[model samples]
Target: MAPEYALNGLFSVKSDVFSFGILVLEVISGLKSKGFYHPNHSQNLIGHAWKLWNEGRPLELIDICLASSCMLSEALRCIHVSLLCVQHHPEDRPNMASVVIMLGSEIALTHPKQPGFFTKMESHEAGNQSSSTNEMSITLLEPR
Candidate 1:
């Protein structure tokens, strides 16, 4: 979920863009954003991707299965566009049309600003955490 929608129940085109960015990352990494655990870090899949990107190691994010089949430049372009889609501010994110153009062309992409909702958890804190996700659910039906 986009940070604004998750925190304030607000949804918009930009929120959908955020979701698209996550989906792109998931496809590239072959990992789900939620329940993503890294042995050496507490960052989720998005945070991990962002870190690798910032460190000039974005290619490390590609799934091993795709290494032989995918074009490296195309993969890098997708990563760049995905980052643009997930900018911290809604106004900074491009519309769907712009995103489509970006993906289809070799236009130089602007550097992405920090992503929203990337609060880092202390490694120890992450390990000591319980199963609560801070979300509540109500069960209305009983098993037959």
Candidate 2:
């Protein structure tokens, strides 16, 4: 689920883009975002992908099985496009038409900003505990 939808009960075209981005990441990595686990960090699949991307190791996110058959450049482009779709702000995300163009062409992609719900989980935290990160707090001001 997109962070805005999950937290604010808001939904939009960008929300579907976020979901698509996650699906792309999951497809490439052969891992589910909800239950993603990494021995070295508490990041879920999206965070882990972002970490690898920042470290110039995006290829490391690809599944080993596909590594043998997938075109490296295409995989990298997909990752780039997926990241763009999942930007933290809905305004920052491209529309579906742009996403299709990005996937089908060699156009240059912009660097992805921090993703929504980018919060890190505790290393000891279990997957069953709140699948989505809840970092934002709302304090409703009610005057009596």
Worst 10 residues of 2 by lDDT: 123-132
TM-score between model 2 and native: 0.85
User: Any runs in candidate 2 off by more than 4 Å, and if so which?
Assistant: 126-144
Residue range 18-87, candidate 2, lDDT tens digits: 9999999999998998877787778888899999999999999999998899999999999898888888
Residue ranges of candidate 1 with Cα displaced over 4 Å: 122-144
**Tens-place lDDT digits, model 1, residues 1-97:** 8888888899977999998998998988888877677777898777888899999999999999987899999998888888888777888888888
Clashing residue pairs for model 1: none
Could you report the Cα RMSD, in angstroms, for every candidate shown? Answer: 4.1, 9.2
**How much is 13 displaced in model 1, in angstroms?**
2.3
